[model samples]
Target: MQTTSHILMIRPVQFGFNAQTAVNNAFQQVNNETGVQEKAQQEFDRFVALLRGHGVDVTVIDDTPQPHTPDSIFPNNWISFHHDGSVILYPMFAENRRLERKPHIIGKIAEQFRIGRTTDLSDFEAKNLYLEGTGSMVLDRTHKVAYACLSPRTHPEVLKAFADATGYETVEFHAADAQGVAIYHTNVLMCIGDDYAVICLDAIPSKEERKYVEEKLKGSRKTVIAITLDQMNHFAGNMLQVQSLRGRKLLVMSTQAFSSLTPGQITELSSFNPIVHAPLDVIEKNGGGSARCMMAEIHLPGKG
Candidate 1:
C-alpha cells in the first residue's frame, strides 16, 4: 500500500537553474549552457518513457510558460494526491515554487483521478514557515509515519500541522552534509519503499537520532539498506518502489543513482523488486532533485 502504480509529472517549458533554490540546495550545480532547457526537456521525455515502459501509469501535465516557474518539473514539492480523495498542498520554501501549485494542474488531473477535496497548508507561508510536500518528508504511507529531516524548509510547527491534519506520526531529525550544512530536503538522504528503506545514517548528526531512525525502520519490519554519504550525494538514496499496472513491484531511480550503487547493494535491493532508471543529468544538475523528487505518486481512486 505504500507504493502506487499511478504517478504525476510536470513537463517543463522553462526548465533551468533556480537561484532561489541554490541558496540552500547543495546538490544543484549552476550551469549556463545555451541548450539547458532543450536538454532538460529531452531528459524529461526519456524519463517518462522509461516509466511508461515499466507499465507505470503516469499523468503528464505541461507547465505554463507564462508563470516562468523553473522548478515546476519537481511538482512533488508543492502538492500530493492521497487515496482518500484528499489532495494536500504544502507551502514551498522558494517563492517561485509556489507558482507551481496551479489550480489548472489539479483540474487536469481530476479528469481521470477522483479528487474529492483539497487541504491548503499554504497559509503557513504568511508565517514564514514552509514544508515542501514530499521533499520535506519521505512518507511511510502504510504505517502512517512521516520521516522528516528538519531544515530551513521544514519547520516543526508545519510538521505538527500536517500530522494534526492527516493523523500521521512525524519522525524528525536534523540532517546535514560533512560541512554541517543542512541537506535541504529529506528525500535526498533516504527513501521509504513498501518493504525496505535506503538511508544514509551518517547524515544524521545526532547519534541518538541515528539509532532512533534505525530502530523505527526495523520496528516497521523494513529491511534496511544503508548507503554512505558519498552514495547518497550521488542520488543513490532517492529511490521509490512502485507496483506496475500488471502487478509487479519495481524500484525506480536515476541512472546516476543506479550506477552509484555497489554490487552488493544492488543485489540486496533487487531481492525486493526489479530496478528501473533513466538519464536525468540536465534535470538533476539544475534542479537539485533527482528521480524521486520529480515523481508525485497519485494514490487517488480512479474516476468511475
Candidate 2:
C-alpha cells in the first residue's frame, strides 16, 4: 500500500524561526520568538485532533527542551519508518537539526511496532554531504522509486547511497522556483499519491527531465496533475494521501494550500480522494513545512 493510517508527529517544545534552514528555505519567515512555541503547540494539537477526527492514527510525542531544536516538529526529515520493519535515519544539513534524532523516540515507537534492522546514513554529515529523509526524496513505494531534486541539502552521492540502502531506483532532477533559485526539498515541489502525482512541472526547466518524470508517472499508472509555480509557493504540491480507519482515501494539506488550488485541480484531486485541510499559518511561516512535513507516516507492522 502507498499510504498508511499510522503516523508519527513531534509536538513542538521550542518552535521558532530556524536561521540554518532559512538560507535555502524561502518560505520561512521570522515572527516574534516570544510565545511562538505556545502558539505552535496550539496549532499542532488542533491539527492532530483534526487528523484523529478523520480516523487517522496519530502518535504525538512531546519534544525535549534541552536540545533547543526549533525544527524538531518536522520529524520526517530525520528518520523514516518502513513497512519491512526497518528504520532509516538520514543526515541533516543543519548542525542543530541533527540533534533531533533520539534513540528514545524510536524506542517509544518500538513499543507498538516491531522494528527490524536500523540503517544510519548520518555518517555523511562528516563529509558535509546530506540528504534530509523524505524531505529531499519523495518515495513511490509501490514502484520502488525515489524522486529527488538536487540541492545543498540533497546531494547526489547521498541520494545514491539511500537508493543503494533501500533498493530503490533514483530519479534525479534539478528543480528551481520562479526566480530560478533551487528549491531546498523535493516535497516542496511534488508529491506522489497512489493513482496520481501533484507536481510543479514548470519548476523542472529541463524538458528531457520533465518528460522523464512524467513518463515514469504515466508508466506507474498515475494521472499527472500539474500545478503552477505560484501554486507551489502556496504549498499546493506539499500534500499527502492516507487511508482512514474506515478505508476511505483522504488527501491532506494545509488550508492555505487547499485555497491556492484551482477549481479544476481540486476536482481532479477529488476524483481520487477527498481533501482534508487545517489552518497551519503559524507553523508554515516559522517552520517552512506544512501538513505533509508534520506527519511521518508509520508503515511498520504492529507487534504480534
Candidate 3:
C-alpha cells in the first residue's frame, strides 16, 4: 500500500504556462500579485512540510529551468511507481506534457528502490493513443484493478497496455463533466484506497455503470464515500488515503475539497480516517489540479 510519506513531487520552476493542459485546463493563470515561480515554491514547501508532518517521506526534485514543463507539479500524470519494482511511463496527450517524463527522475528514484523494468508506453502517442498515467486511471493496487473512464484524453489501447504490463484488470466507463463535456482525467473524479473510495457517481450518468462500480467497491470491502456534483466541482472527489508515521491513516485533500464537504460527509469520512487538508488556491486556480495531482506515490520495494 502507498502512503503520502512515500511519494514524489517536482517543484515547479515555470508553474504558470502549461500549453498541454491548456487544451482542457482553462483554470491556469499567471498572477501578478504572486509571481509564478515564487508561488510554486511556497506551495511546494507547505505541501512537503504537511506530508512530512504526517510521517510521509517525500522525495522532492527541482524542475530544470532549461526545459520548462509548466505542469511539472502534477508528476503522477507522467510516471507511476509500482510495488513490483516496474516503472511505467505514460503517453500524454499534450506535447508539452510528454516532455515531463524525464529519465533522470527515474534514475534519481533508482537510488532507493530496485527498478526491475521500465515500460515506455509514450511511443503509442504516434497512433493518437494516450493514458496520462494515474490521471487517466485510479488504481486499486491491492486488488490489481484499474478504474478508467474513457474519453478523448484516455485511450483504451494504452489502458490495456498498462493492464497487461502491470497484471491489472480494467474497469472502463464514460464520464462527463458539469457541462456534459467529457471529464479529462479519471483522478479528478475518484480515488481508491485500502479501505475506502471517494467518487463522484453523478459524473457517470449511466445507471448500470455506476451500479457496477458501486458493487465492485462493496465486493472489495471498501466503504463508499459518495460526493455530490457540487462537491466534485470543488475537487472533493480528488482525495487520497495514506498512512502516517504512526501507522494511522490520513485522508488528504485540498482546503477547497474540505470546505465543499457537507457535515454528514465529513463525519462519515472521519470515521474511517482523519482528514488532512492544505490551502491550494493558487495552485488549483492556475494548475487545474489539486493535492492528488501533486503526488506520485512510491510503492516500489526498497533496494536494501
Candidate 4:
C-alpha cells in the first residue's frame, strides 16, 4: 500500500499557545488576546472531516482533561508505529508533552494490528537529549532513509539510535529559522514523499550540506520540489503525501500552506499528486505546526 487508510490525530482540549515549546519553536505565537482555542478546535474538526471525506480513515482521540499538554495536538511526536511490528517511543523536548504517550492508545491499535516489540527511547530525556519522533525525522520508507535536521530539540544521539533500531540511513543536516536559530523540527523545513521531496534549500546555510541533500534526493529518483524560506515559513514544506482508500495519492497540507503556493508551483506539484488542505490558522499560530504535525500515519500491517 502506498499509504495507510488509518491516521491518528489528537483533538486539543486545552488548545492554546504553548509556552514550553515556544522556547525552541519560533513559529509559535507568544501572546494572543483573542480566544483562539475554539477556532483551533473547529479547524481540527474540519480537517478530520475533510480527510474522512477523501476516504482517508482517521482515528480522532480527545486529549486528557487534566495535566494539560498544550502540544499534545501533534501526536506524531510522542510515538511512531512501524510495519515491522516495532513501536518507537520518542523523548520529547517539552516536559508536558511527555504525557501524551498513553499505553491505551497502543492497546487500541493492537486490536487491528500486530504488536512485535516496543522501544522506549525516553531515557535520553534524562540526559537532556531529545528526538520528537516523526517531527524530528521524516522517513523515506521506500528507500529506508531518515532525513533530519539538527536542532536543540533533536539530538544526534537519538537520531543515530533510531537509525540503528529502524535500519534506516540517516541523512542529517543543519537547519535554521529566519532569525538564524536552529529549526526545532525536521518536518517544518521539509517532507519526503514517495517519489518527490519538498524542501527549503535556503534553510541549509552550508553549500556542501545543501549539495549533498540535493544529490541524495536525485540519486533516489525523486523530483526535488524546492520551496523558498518564505514559503517554508508559511508551512509549504510541511506537506505529506498519503494514499486514499481508492489507492490514489493525496498531497496533504494546511490551507495556509496551500495559499502560499504560486500557480506554477501548484501546477508542478499537481503533476505528482492531488492536493488536500484544511484551514489551520489557529493551530498553526498557537501550536506552531501544520497539517503534517497533526497526523501520525499507522504503518502497522493490518488484519486481512
Steric clashes per prediction: 0, 0, 3, 0
Deviation in Å, model 4, residue 295 alpha carbon = 0.1
lDDT per model, in order?
A: 0.92, 0.92, 0.85, 0.88
- Deviating ranges (above 4 Å) for candidate 2: none
lDDT tens digits, residue span 1-304, model 4: 3356778898888888878888889898776547777788899999999999998988887877777877778999989888888899999988888988877777787888887889999999999999998899988888888889999888899998998899999999999867898989999888888788899999999999999998998898889989999999999988888877788789999999999999998998899888999999889988999999999999887866
Model 2, residue 292: distance off in Å is: 0.6
- Residue 178 C-alpha lDDT in model 1: 80
Please report, as a residue range, the 10-residue window in candidate 3 with the lowest summed lDDT. 25-34
Candidate that beats the other on TM-score, 2 or 3, i.e. the better one: 2
Q: For model 1, give the 10-residue run with minimal summed lDDT.
A: 30-39
TM-score, predicted candidate 4 vs. hidden true structure: 0.97
Residue-level lDDT tens digits of model 2 in 93-176: 999999999878998999999999899999999999999999999999998899999999999999988888889999999999
- Could you estimate the TM-score for every candidate? 0.99, 0.98, 0.95, 0.97
As a TM-score, model 3 comes out at: 0.95
What C-alpha RMSD separates each model from the true structure? 0.7, 1.0, 1.7, 1.1
lDDT of each residue in 195-273, candidate 3, tens digit only: 8889999999899999998898888889898888788778887788878657888888999999999899899899988
Error of 3 at 291 (Å): 0.2
Q: Stretches of candidate 4 above 4 Å error? A: none
